[model samples]
Target chain A: MIPVTIEQMSMRFGAVKVLHDVNLTVQAGECFGLIGESGSGKSTVLRCASLLQDGWRGRAMIGDTSVRDMSVAQRCRSLQMVFQDPYGSLHPRHSVRTVLSEPLKIHAIGDAPDRMRAALRDVGLPAEFLDRYPHQMSGGQRQRVAIARALILDPKVVFLDEPTSALDVSVQAEILNLLMRLRSEKGFTYIMVSHDLAVVDHMCERFAVMQHGRIVEVLDRDAITGAGAKTSYARELIGASLAYENAL
Target chain B: MDPILTVRDLSVHYPGAPVCAVKSVSFTLGRERLGIVGESGSGKSTVGRALMRLLPDAKLSAQTLTFEGVDLLAASERQMLRLRGARMSMILQDPKYSLNPIRRCGEQVAEGVRTHTRCSKKQARDKALAMLKAVQIRNPERVYDLYPHEISGGMGQRIMIAMMLLTDPDMVIADEPTSALDVTVRLQVLSILDDLVRRRGIGLIMISHDLNLVRNFCDRVLIMYDGRVVESIAAGQLDQAQHPYTRGLLAAQPRIGGGRGPLPVLKRDPAWSQPMEIPV
Candidate 1:
């Protein structure tokens, strides 16, 4: 079953059209990647699909319900988004416990204390971190808290926007492993956006290459290793990533 | 050939901090590129700043810190100012914050030249335009008058390079210079640096977290961890590094042909924080 779908989606900011007739379908329990450089409308697609940007044209569906028709409570239960910058996404004044429980409190979900502790453990953070502020945590620890906040509600679909780009190589490995482990245990669908081809290849099985606000090609993981990408832009991106690897 | 700069037993400690940020780091640089590779809070950038005496708040001490036989630690502030832009210069990570927002790109480059050399405004402006062209900026005249906000990120970085190289500094310390750039543009920027090092015979200290880039670009590499140099190896010999920290970092990066699997997280060892054993 398809957990998330976008058909003929178009978005314009006044005179500028950011997304042009974008379409995507994510399967249940699959990790789909959206790969592009800056200003490629990949994040806009996530925003439109998650109902964060309601001014887009065309239909976006989460499970069986269209995004426009879903109620606030239904939307909260179905999909959630994780932003690129963990430091900016989290509230500085709030403790880790407070940050995880706010979504539950807003949705009127009972047993907040138990759910918060479980969320911390699920993200591999100690229960003692509940009273710590965002500033007190490292970049990796803060990102884990952000992931916990996103998954605390048990949403069916989650969108990750450049999840580990800000982290160090070692810390990035830890976060990527944690994300993969969580997907297997919970069986939730993920839509990950990134500019790094190696990272996208590791996390996602099938990915779409976006250029100038349009998805130029969709390729499988096997295509990444082989010369199977159809578009010149996608080929260039792959070659650049490979060149960066060997550049040292 | 004699070294351009030499540092021995260098350490930095900011006020109120229990542990030193950089601990007894020692190195020697000639006309070749040296890379300092480490994660955040590993004191890689601190080493760079301490060399230039830029960290005002940090208390710095060294057995011997010399640049071309001149004692940097004992140099007065006025003498250091004269040597800064003329003999030694730095390129920051982001050109957006480094370049002045309101000044014309050409004027900024010309200002550096005029301050360093006893040149007229016209002479300084001509030298600036020539340097911009050297960095591969097409239509130098048009770009010369543009402000920082008008140009693209790649162009802005080139402009910063043009400005920094105007005075022909003998040594350049670049801190994560290409991290903010796109992969394709990163190559272009790096090649520009490579050209400068070859043509001018200037020593370079590249501070970055990217191990692959350092391995391929620099002649030597220093693997720093927790304010200490854990391993120092030739760039070509990075794969044979003996330190666990270096091996762990190499394994963490995902490769293209590598299949999907959980990457191994680095387990920190408390013993790695002990004083470094500098090779004689």
Candidate 2:
């Protein structure tokens, strides 16, 4: 059985079908990438899986337990989400300690202090960061805090939605490397959404190319490793991404 | 050939600040695209704004700030007004903040046109629609009447572009015009800018954080760090850059097929932005 299975998930907003008949699976200890342009419904998929977004059809199964049946607490511990826009995703008013510990308090997890400290260390954050607020920190540091907040719950599945899009290149690499390291040490499933083909190509093992609320194609690294792709849309995306990369 | 715009040991400082926001920055813009790229707070925007003398109420003092053949740094308010938007206009970063939210976009653009040419209101309206069409906006007739809040970010950017270009300025300064846009739409906006500049033969200064975009879009590329141009090179040879700072930036980014490994970390040298370059 897949670690997490999203079967025929569909979402709508006032007659607008934002996502339709979307299916995806993230294996345990594997990075599953969802690559698409803006409004491709990739974020919606992460939102659905993390239970951040409700009012949907079909089953989001975390292992054998259906997401439809899990309690709020169960979902929180087993599924955590890291949002894009590090600045906006985090509460500017809250200190790093508060942001990480508040989730534990909500889940009624005891020894909150010890848990917060451990969480900070897990994401490679120094203890000095504990007293600092999000606004005082750099973008990469804030993103690290965000990662720590997600992993503090020790979730079985971690959903990162455009985690490093806003960050500069040098800072972005640090965050990306941190995510990979944390994944190895923790052994949690990762479902990451990004529009950058280079990022997808570098980090992901299995990828689903999304377009206009549907999964247009799914490819392994070996499928179209180089030169070009079979689908015209994929080729265009790959070409444009390549152009940007080569230009860099 | 004489430079369209020249800066001689230029610097812009905030009030009571020891260091300038932009420091000793010297560059020249011909009738071509010149991109100034750097991270946030690196002072790329200050350079662009300083060019047009629109640096807000901030304290600004420069040795030589010349526009075309005129000495703008010493120009009076009346002289500056005549030069402002009509001669050299700036396309600001965020349209939502820059545009008047309550005013209709068409009227605003038409007003921009009227500032320069003695055209009737109806004639100016027609020209606004034509400019909108030039930017590839498919139904200019309908979009012309909408307020800034009513349009999307990309659409709003297009409107800003129309406004800035309407006056037929000699030099156009665009500050992160497409940073808020998606990848596909960024290409669209840039393509429009490229077409407009080429057709009009206007000097262009594009300020952005994305080095790759700057390298490809601009003719001459200036890599700014901590308010100083660390290096300037031909845009086509950006990858073959000589500066350690530039190489570090290029190394830090992950390319499409740049194989996996420990990512390169940029060591921030105290001398990275220092005026002291390696002895020749």
Candidate 3:
């Protein structure tokens, strides 16, 4: 059975149609990527699927169950989202311990202390980090903490929205490696949104290109390095990303 | 041809700080694109700000700092005011904060021209419109009337470029100019800068953190580490870099179709921060 599916999904903010009739499906344990320019509704798609946005018309299913039918608690248990900016996504005043344990307390998950430690350790952070606030940690460390917070619920699916854009290249490498390792170990499906074609090529198995609120093309990983893109827009995006001179 | 700007043993120290934010860094620029790349807190932006005389509170010291045969360090504030926007200008990172929020786009560009040159309002308006077109902004008439909040990121960036390049400055210091832009729009903005450099022979200093971008766009590259230039090499020859920091940075990038293993993380050695021994 497919782990995630969206059929005829559409969104509108006031008079502007941000998303057209979009359709997508992801297999179990697959990393699906959405690529586009700014204002292309990539983040909006993630927001809609993750229940962060309202008034979107369409059917979104996770393993045969409609996403809208799930309760808040069920949704929290089934899916989690990691945002773009770690500095903004994490609460500035909240300690790491509070950030991690709040979700557990809300869900009535016992053994909170042990689970918090395990979550931190899983993300390759030391246990002492729990006492630190977001300001005390570096950008990379804060991102790791955010990852731990998202995975603390042990959700089957995770939405990554430009997870490494705010970070330096070296730190981005660390975070990307950690995400890949965690997915392999836990078998969690990921729907990532990024504008970087190289990052999509490195992590995703297949990706869809969005422009003006529509999916222009969908291709596998091989297409990024080859001439498999059928549309001129996709080809232009690919060429521009590969070499700086070609974009001119 | 003479170099446009020259620096020797330049250093900057903030008040009450134990160590200087920028160590003794020196480089020279001619009629070419020079890139200064480093991670956050590596003082790349600090160097740029020092060059532009933007930092007011910080203590700046250099053995020799000159621009177009004029000593910047010894120049008076009145002299700098005349030379700033007219002779040497700076293009900041984001237009949202750089451009005045309440003003129209064309008026802001025209204001830049009017601040340095004696021109009537009509003349300045025409110059602003022409500069906007040079940055490849289609429908300059419509965009000119719009406010800063009305334009998109790419258009906003192009407008910022237009404002800075309107007066035809001899040197431009662009600090993370395209970091806020996406891949496609980034190239377009860069090509505009590239054209200005080639056609007008302007000396450019691009400050950024994207190694791949610097490698592809700039003629010469200076890799900064701990407020010092650890490696200076031709942009095309980055792979043959000898510094461990540069090699670590290069290996850390997860290239397209790269091996799906754990990427090599950067490991810093404290010895790298020490001054290099000059061979006598």
Candidate 1 residue pairs in clash (backbone atoms < 3 Å):
A248-B216
In terms of TM-score, which candidate is stronger, 2 or 3? 3
Candidate 3, residues B44-140, lDDT tens digits: the string is: 9999988888888999999989999889888888988887888888888887788888999999989978999899999999999999999999899
TM-score, second chain, candidate 3: 0.97
In candidate 3, stretches whose alpha carbon ends up further than 4 angstroms from where it belongs are A245-248, B277-280
Each candidate's iRMS in angstroms? 1.3, 2.1, 2.6
C-alpha lDDT (0 to 100) for residue B82 of candidate 1: 90
Question: Clashes in each model (backbone N, CA, C under 3 Å)?
Answer: 1, 0, 0
lDDT of 2 at A198: 72
DockQ of each: 0.73, 0.54, 0.57
Models 1 onward score TM values of 0.97, 0.93, 0.96
lDDT (10s digit) by residue, model 1, range B1-280:
7899999889999999999999999899999999999999999999999888998898999999999888998998998899888899989999889999999989998999888789899999899999999999999999999999899788888888888888998899989988888765787888898788779998999999999889877999999999999899999999998999999999999888796889988998999988858573
Q: Which ten residues in a row have the lowest lDDT in candidate 3 chain A?
A: A239-248
In terms of TM-score, which candidate is strongest? 1
Mind giving the per-residue lDDT tens digits that candidate 2 earns over B106-152?
Answer: 88888887877888999999999999998888999999898888888
lDDT of 1 by residue, A1-248 (tens): 24788899999999999999998888888999999877789988998888888798989888778988988888877888888888899999999989988899999999998999999999999999999999999999999999999989999888999999899999999999999999999888999998888899889989999988899999997788797898999888878888888765
Question: How close to the true structure is residue B100 of candidate 1, measured as C-alpha lDDT?
Answer: 91
Q: Using TM-score, rank the candidates from best to worst.
A: 1, 3, 2
